[model samples]
Target: MFSPQGPSLRELCVQALSSVEHGYDLLAPKFDHTPFRTPQSMLDATTRALSGLGPFRTGLDVCCGTGAGMGVLGALCQDGTTGVDFSSGMLGQARSAYPNASFVRADARALPFDAGFDLAVTFGALGHFLPEERPALFNGIYRALRPGGLLAFPAGSRPPVTSIAHWATLGFDLALRVRNAVWRPPFVMYYRTNTMQEVSRDLTATGFTVRTVPLSPPGYNLVIARK
Candidate 1:
């Protein structure tokens, strides 16, 4: 699933053994080469989907990682784009790639931003937050948006029970549970936890008018929440 330029298996093992923040720091340089990086096509599809909803002013990308989501925000927002992530190494890479865009180092659970952005987007990061953590996460995103502003992210629908991906995801989460049980620093990446019903309920409770926008690339939908 990784390109030749991506982290070696040994390097990935070291990263999996470290804390998420430090692990990301170690993996930052090779991250974009990995399949874990959000694909350009997904970002393009999202931009096309959000274009009608936007042409926004200031944009924010929460848990922005290597700043892939910024492409969408940068295109849609006339003013500027900002990417917030806790890993300094990740932020460094983002800043290097998109120097004109603002990059902030902050945890997603407690985002350090006021209601100042017209639009906010996050990608490939929800699996990092557990079920109980959703409340704090959704609330933080809610607080980061201006009145009538929107927070958006793409989430994959559950793979069919008959599909290989379904079994693979289940096995991965099980392996993670086993690893966390025996390991020191848990790598919190679960693929199948964020269901549409559960996430919509949380977003609604956090004061967003939630809706799902179906899009291309198959089995993916944009979860749009308006304040």
Candidate 2:
């Protein structure tokens, strides 16, 4: 659902046809007013979860759309925080919202940082990366963190086939597939392509020690990968 302040249906249709970066650029201004933005409930849970794992120094937010992870990281980390996203439009919103925090425009697959951060987090941005793109993405995140640094995010579990969510997500993924099959500049978001097992394997392959814990929200879990 979207608020009155959010983009109109026509605007969403236009965004759907654009490349992921451009689509997000178009959507960035009103992102927080839409359901697509990471909810405060999840951010709050992330903050609470990371609080125990940290007395962290520097923090990074991978694919930091509108800097949702900035607030989460700020609450947990003691010093510097940065939000990295490819979209200039998204970074603009983030800059306006958190002027004191750093924001960078860079692709997640080629993150431009050394092992400088003690902690990192991502929110609601994974679906844009294809299954094959994940290794590079994970590697970049892993490489950005210092030794013993943690990269964390709230991960969703697969819903059973009998459930409404399962069918809904399946339908959504199917629609995206069909759209990509017929369109140029394909939008990369999908509902069910990635799995926890696959993600864990990727993290491990990238030299992370991976683990998960049940988050406060009933259906979501947190995947923590330590460098």
Cα lDDT computed for each candidate against the true fold: 0.93, 0.91
lDDT of 1 by residue, 176-196 (tens): 889889998888989988888
Model 1 residue runs over 4 Å out of place are none
Off by over 4 Å in 2: none
User: Count of backbone clashes for each model?
Assistant: 0, 0
Q: How far out, in Å, is residue 78 in model 1? A: 1.0
The TM-score between candidate 1 and the true structure equals 0.98
Give per-residue CA lDDT, model 2, range 69-125, as digits (tens): 899988988888999999999999999989989988999999999998999999987
Model 2 pairs whose backbones collide: none
